[model samples]
Target: MMNLKYQMIIQWSEDKSFLVGFPEFPGQTWRTHGDNYQEAVNNGIEALESLVIAYQTTGETLTKPTFNQAA
Candidate 1:
């Protein structure tokens, strides 16, 4: 997934009282949450790295990201 750049969608949930971020690829759901915006961004990066590692380890090709939605 070296050439791939996934978009991260972030939002603040009043109910959860935290920031949440997730990749925007099709079939992808859920997100990593954080106590603040910066933490949420950090979590999103970790999530993307984890995704890359998983795909690499399993020898599965990751779909190229269409855009970057991170803020």
Candidate 2:
């Protein structure tokens, strides 16, 4: 299990579904989506896991997570 902390942005799309995206990983805007909010979160987590695994399997460097400091 990968315990990497990354950003997952979920927003309602015009298609009437929730879209998920990872800001840390560029190039692709939307990765996984869902019909509802909960589903979107679940799909986002799965997508994040797969992304990390893919990066590791390919011996590629994983992007550093952005830490937002509390003001």
Candidate 3:
């Protein structure tokens, strides 16, 4: 699990599902989603964890967050 916090954007799509996006990661516009908001958030977190692992395995530096997070 990654301790770093990245931005997760959850929005309602026309398909009537929650679309999840990671603005900090440079890849697909929408990473993962779900039928509901909670599901979307859970999926997004899992996707983010996988993404972090992928970057680490590839020895690629992650992009800096666009916004600062409050402690």
- For model 2, how does the per-residue alpha-carbon lDDT over 19-55 read when each residue is reduced to its tens digit? 9999999764899999999999999999999998889
Model 3: colliding residue pairs: none
Q: Residue 47 deviation, candidate 1, in Å?
A: 1.1
Error of 1 at 19 (Å): 4.4
Worst 10 residues of 3 by lDDT: 60-69
Residue by residue across 1-71, what tens digits does model 3's lDDT show? 56767899999999999999998887758999999999998899899899888898999998877777599
lDDT of 1 by residue, 1-71 (tens): 24446777778787664555445555556567787878887787787788778888999887776753698
RMSD list, candidates in order: 4.2, 1.0, 2.2
Per-model TM-score versus the true fold: 0.71, 0.93, 0.87
Which segments of candidate 3 are over 4 A away from where they belong?
69-71
- lDDT of candidate 2 at residue 27, scale 0 to 100: 67
> What is the C-alpha local distance difference test score of candidate 2?
0.92
**Model 3 / residue 62 / CA error / Å:** 0.8
Q: What overall lDDT, based on C-alpha atoms, would model 1 receive against the true structure? A: 0.69
Every candidate's lDDT = 0.69, 0.92, 0.89
